[model samples]
Target chain A: MRNKFAEALYRLSRSDPRIHIVVADISPAGPMNEFRKEFPERFINVGVAEQSMIGICAGLALKGMLPFAYTIATFALYRPFEMVRDDLCYQNLPVTVVGIGGGVIYSTLGGTHYAQEDITIAGAIPNMSILAPCDPAEATAATEYLVGADRKGPCYLRFGKAGEPDITKDAIEPFRFGKLRYLRRGRDVAILSYGVTMGLAVKAAAALADKGKSVSVIGCPTVKPLDREGVIEVLRSHPRVVVAEENAPRGGLASEVKSVAWDIQARCALQTITLKDEFVHCYGSHEDLLAAHGLSVPAIVAAAGG
Target chain B: MSAAPRRLANDFDTTAARERCYRLRRRILDVSQHVSALHVAPAFSCMEIVDCIYHGLMRKDESGAYLDTFLMSKGHGCMTQYAILESHGTLPRSALDEYCTKDGLLGAHPDYGTPGIAASTGSLGHGLGMAVGMAVAERNAAKAKGRPVPTIYTVLSDGEVQEGSTWEAVMMASTLGVDNLVAVVDNNDFQSLGRTSETHPSFYPLVEKFQAFGWETVEVNGHDAGAVFRAVTARKGAGKPFMTVAKTVKGRGVKYMESVPIWHYRAPNPAEYKQALEILEKVQS
Candidate 1:
């Protein structure tokens, strides 16, 4: 997924001079060396200055350039929220904020680097479109969509570290902003998720199916300006809906799904599999955080009563 | 001191201009009091600075052409800006009365839709970047169309220097050789939480810091309108942005209010309001 995202970025930069990237002295760590080498004039590395980098990107966007600000999710979203609000969202500039190491992807770095709260913060901002793709193919699709589309405001794209399994097929429909794709269909329950967590969701659904329970998995790549109609369709068809994400339960995907359910008067049982209120104290890899948070396939299957 | 006073036309008078500054200060106090807004201290601090720009630096006819470009990045001091615009007849006095009210264009911060307001700002650390971008754009557009470049001015609060974005804009402005840009920092020594020295200390060694960043720097007493006017009207640097560190006093005209931290947030009550009005009336008298 990381390679695909980089390739898409490189391809987009080839045609659009307006597409620029601001690195926060962590381009090599964020896997953006190729982009730096390719577009030197368009690439800016304001060393270790996360807040200023975001501001500079906002300024570039205001000057009629489309800037993609790259950094780890923790520093990208939390460190410069005021800049995002004032410089980008307030003016509705087309600054694409690309956050790598989302969720537990930075597990080795512990809680400081973990990006479990990105969705909550990004979701709260108005005029900001959030995209968390399921795989490399999906990431490429999202990149193309954001670069080419005439968006109303700024956007945020969250992706994990490299070498994730591909969940999307080449023949699938082209990605659209705020649209959902039903990866699998069943009758008993609907499994909804996005980002790298979609892999767990798919595995959980397959496991549930093996136990004689029909489970459907929906991949919602876009989190904000949510596909309300798509969510309504899934709720109407299934007796229960389970929202699984790597973010906190509060104000994340589950919260959005709940809002939709309430508005449409859907009586389906809505369950959310997410991180608890307290921070993770144990130290391990990304996989450890996932297992500890009960986001693993086996845990999700058990939660679904399979 | 013996230099001839630079005049706009036959009607320009130093005594009249001084009187206008006092009137402008009064309007700022009234509008701010009515709106119950903060930043009154900083707003008062920048009155003469604004007056100097409107009367001395800006060319009346060319000012209208550059309306789409001016940005008050230090948006907290919007009352001063409103008063200056109203005095210039660019904005109506009624709008000042409706400031910070619901459905009012004059927000506590300057908004884009308000007459003569270039960009919406209240959020710190954004105005300078926007100004830099605008200046760069003007330069690019001029090159493309073979037209003269438009001037861009951004006002910065001393507290805003703590924000890294200010430096980012500074770097870019220098890198791009943005000669048409001018940034004025209102150095009133106070921020939102406390004094600049107490909160986030900035040792701005003004000229050295800006000169190192490729800017032609100037220092002036912000209250002295003559010095401000002279500094702004000076010749532009060769392919480098200009910066002015204007030393100012928070709550300049109001005697009891000057240099008081409470004035940063506290709105004037009826008694204080009356007293402020009286002081303004005496200045006018």
Candidate 2:
């Protein structure tokens, strides 16, 4: 997904002289390397200065220049939160802040590298659009949508580390901001998943099918400006709804669904498969950490009452 | 009364500029009378610096639009900007009269959409980095259009130097060689509650810090509009970024408030207001 974002940006920059790329100390490999090579004048690498990167992007936007500030999720959102609020959100500039390594994608590097609270941080700010793409295809589409002529505001484009599979490939609807996409339809139980966790929901749905029980897999790519009416309708039709995400259980998709269900007083049973509120002190691979924190496929199936 | 908008000329006199500063300070005191919770001392510290920029240093075209941009990173000192903008005719007299009121466009901080405000800044350590970015964009625009680069000036407080983001912008500006960027640090020697020198002893040797970072640095009396004008104009188009350490006094115009920390954000009482006005009236520009 990260590489696809760079490729999409590089392709878009070919004709738009307004597009400028700013990165921190992160090494520019793969498609990003090609972008810097092609547009050396527009590529700016403010070494290890995330706050300055955001401030600089705001200035670029002031001059009618479109700037994309790319860095890791924790560095992009946490260290320079005031900068994001003061420079970007307050002024409501058209700066695309790309935060790679969402959730536990950087699990081996310990808790410091994880980005569990990004959704909460971004959701708290007004006029901030949050997009957590599920795969490379959706990542490209979201990038294009954000950099389009009309999408003029601050936005957070959250992606996983690398090589997230194309879970949204077989979906009936194409990628659109603030829309809930259904990957598979079933009447028994509905599984609502966000970002890279959509694949787990799909696997869990198929596993439930083996027992002659029908299950639906829904992908939630746009976390902010959620499909509230669609979620209420889904709750009305389904007897059970399960939310799967790799973020902290407090303020991600699960919380949004719960809030909507509470407001409508839906009679359906709701459950969430997510990481614990505490930090993950253990070290392992991304899959290992997800399974340990109850965000795996089995956890989603269990949450669905399978 | 509003001053007529004028273009920058080669032989402008400093007496007019100083008198303008005195008038701006008086306007700031007027704002203080209306609003109780604003940084009066902080505003006084940067009055002349901002006045010189808008009235003397920054060039204006025939259309009354500034060719160069100015940002106030030290947000608490926003009354200085509001007063200057109002007097410069960019902002209306009614707006200054209604500051902090329910129907006023002006507030305790500078907002972006307000006329003459480049960026919404009050958060310390934020303006310089954005200034660097504007400088870079101006340079790019100049290179593409074959025109001279426009400058981006920002006023930061002395206490704001403690923020890490300030140095981060400093490093990036020097490395990018943003020659059109100018940062003036209002070194009033006082933070919000205490003296910066007493609290942060290692922060001295400030000019050398910018010089070492590859900037053309200068130190001058911030209250002297002529000195500031000379420092900035002497290095115009000098092929490197510039930093001016303007040594100023908090609550500069009024003797009772000068260098006093308690006067940081206080409106004057009836007796104090009377005394302050009398002192300001008797002063020579």
Judging by DockQ against the true structure, name the best candidate.
2
Model 2 regions lying over 4 Å from their true place: B1-10, B236-238, B281-285
Q: At residue B122, give the lDDT of candidate 1.
A: 84
Q: For candidate 2, state the interface root-mean-square deviation in angstroms to 1 decimal.
A: 0.6
**Model 1 lDDT per residue over A1-306, tens place:** 877887888877887777777767674533356777876656777667667677667656766778888888988888888888777787788888888998878887888888888888888989998999989889988888888865657888899978888886732445678888877778999898999999888888878888899888888899988998999998899988888888987888888899889899998888888877668767787768888887788877876777
Per-model C-alpha lDDT, please? Answer: 0.77, 0.85
lDDT, model 1, position A70: 85
Write out the backbone clash pairs for model 2: B75-B122
DockQ of each: 0.31, 0.78
TM-score of chain A of each: 0.95, 0.97
